[model samples]
Target: MSIAPKPNPALAELAVLEGEWVIELSNAKFLPGSNSRAQGRVSAEWLDNSALVMRQWQWRRQGDLDHRA
Candidate 1:
């Protein structure tokens, strides 16, 4: 049998950030383009009994392929 881990009080405050978010960047040097725009999505979730907030993001820059981490 497995027992669920208890939520950490300290991490509780970060729970508010657990949701989908939109990020926008303009004229980024790395993208290197005229009026370039970088649009990305960020999603975070609590893990290890709320001890850590893990995030996975993906982005696309003008004239560039999708990037993820």
Candidate 2:
């Protein structure tokens, strides 16, 4: 029989962000035009209960799609 290893406390601490979140950006110069607004959804979760990974998708007001790992 095989036994699973205990989870690391530091890694477990990331559980606080294990949910869907709404992100909004306003008055950002990163956009093509000035004074832009963007919104998206961020999903965070643990990978195999060991590491935390976040995936984000955003749509800019200028019809642009952005993703982050």
Candidate 3:
């Protein structure tokens, strides 16, 4: 079996951002005739005993770009 690596000192410093966040887009008109608006969420967490940090994002509405990394 594989083992989890030790936590990195540098990764510990990023703990402050370990949580969920809401995203918003306004007046970022990708189209015409009106101001466009959208919303989504972003989440960050430690992986493998803080050996790495993983972040994922998703946007509201449609058109691809809807998955975890």
Q: Each prediction's Cα RMSD?
A: 2.7, 3.1, 4.5
lDDT of 3 by residue, 1-69 (tens): 987688888777788778888877676656232555566888878787664354788776444355444
Query: What's model 1's overall lDDT?
Result: 0.80
Please, what is the whole-model Cα lDDT of each candidate in the order they appear? 0.80, 0.71, 0.68
Q: Is candidate 1 or candidate 2 better by TM-score?
A: 1
Models ranked on lDDT: 1, 2, 3
Clashes of each: 0, 0, 0
The prediction achieving the highest lDDT against the true structure is: 1
lDDT of 1 by residue, 1-69 (tens): 988888888777787778889998886677677688899998987776655554789998876789999
Local accuracy of candidate 2 as per-residue lDDT tens digits, 1-69: 976666778776678888888878787878665667787778877766677778555454557756554
Give stretches of model 3 more than 4 Å off: 1-4, 26-35, 61-69
What would the TM-scores of all predictions be?
Answer: 0.66, 0.62, 0.51
Residue 11, candidate 1: Cα error in Å is 1.0
